[model samples]
Target chain A: MRYGAEILVYLKEGVLDTQGKAVAASLTRLGYDDPSVRVGKYIRVEIEASDIDSAKETFDKMCKDLLVNAIVEDYTVKVEELR
Target chain B: MRYGAEILVYLKEGVLDTQGKAVAASLTRLGYDDPSVRVGKYIRVEIEASDIDSAKETFDKMCKDLLVNAIVEDYTVKVEELR
Candidate 1:
């Protein structure tokens, strides 16, 4: 079967996001006071897996091994059966 | 009141994603056969808005004005009430 996975990869808390900071500052300058925006990557993938469980396992492995830099980032994975 | 918005910013179809292609190639090399991956930005924000209707409008404006490059990118905004 085929499955779809959405992986959200984000910087860990306390890691300064320079890009996010710049965005926040830009918004504030435009009078959108105190906007807190953290930018990250959203990866969408379609994979062939035996079942939901195996899909989840594959997603976890993918994130850990290649998708995310665990030392500086954290990721959340959501899997669904694809038609 | 405060509202939370999750903004998914992605390259529009037909736009080539060099980074995504590199990742896909890396996965194939690792034996994760024919993995299809598309990468984009995920932005999370907490904003002060009067109501849901207004909140959605604000999110839309943010995306149009600063968050997304409309020519090559498309974005979806999801808003929720925040405690």
Candidate 2:
């Protein structure tokens, strides 16, 4: 079976986000209220697996091995069977 | 009131995603199956607004004005009141 996984990787709390800060400043300068912003990566991947469990397992390994930076980032993943 | 908005920006259909292609190729080389991948941006913003509708409106303007590349990318945003 094939599955689709959506992975969101974000910086850990308390970590400085220079990009986000810059964006927020821009918005404020553009007349929006003082807004707080955080930026992250959203990755969608299609995987071939026998079942949902194995698909999720593969996603976990992918995150740990390559997708996420464990030292400063955290990730959440959701997987659904692709019809 | 305070509101939180989550925005996802992705390339339109048929747009070439070089970064995604590179990551997918690396994953395959690292023994994962030939998975198809798409990469996007996830932005979380906190805004001060009177209501959810206004918050969404602000988000729309944000996307149009600065957050998204309208020619090659599309975006979806969801807003919820912050407690």
Candidate 3:
């Protein structure tokens, strides 16, 4: 199966998103009006695997072991099979 | 043309992502291991428009006015034409 997975990761509320705020400021400087902003990450990965189970196992492990950091971010994965 | 656009918004480096961290914890509790997490947002928009310029205008406006809050995030858009 062709494993195409999209994962979205985001910071918890109240976490200071200095980067996001800075971007907002830049936007205003560039004449764009931005009232609020939330920053998050999105990743799309295509994997070569056997089935849903293996895909899940690999992705789940990847996310836990490398993709997501338990200390600063959370992630969710949506898997799609293309074959 | 069928306008398919994908935009990714991310916090500048040094920005804190609290929500992402929380999710990492949840994953760990749920039996996943996470090391470091960075949170950002990804948006995919499909618009029925005339051409690239129009699609650009619509998306640029949407990101500035609605999709991205200039105050907290930086966004870049990629457009694909589907006929």
Chain A alone, TM-score per model: 0.94, 0.98, 0.83
What is the lDDT, from 0 to 100, of the residue B31 in candidate 1? 77
As a TM-score, model 2 comes out at 0.98
Compared with the true structure, what per-residue lDDT tens digits does model 2 show for residues B1-83?
99999899999989999989999999999999998999999999998998889888999999999999999999999889999
Specify the highest-TM-score model's number: 2
Candidate 2 regions with alpha-carbon error over 4 angstroms: none
Which prediction has the highest lDDT against the true structure? 2
- For model 3, how does the per-residue alpha-carbon lDDT over A19-54 read when each residue is reduced to its tens digit? 667655655666543324445668555566779988
lDDT of 1 at B25: 93
Note the clash tally of each candidate.
0, 0, 23
Tens-place lDDT digits, model 1, residues B32-77: 8688899999998889998999989988888988999999999999
- The candidate with the higher TM-score, 1 or 3, is 1
10 residues in a row with least lDDT, candidate 2 chain B? B47-56
Reference-based lDDT, residue A28, model 1: 83
* Interface Cα root-mean-square deviation for all models: 0.9, 0.6, 7.5
Model 3 regions lying over 4 Å from their true place? B1-6, B9-59, B62-83
DockQ of 2: 0.92
lDDT of 1: 0.90
Q: Is candidate 2 or 3 superior in TM-score?
A: 2
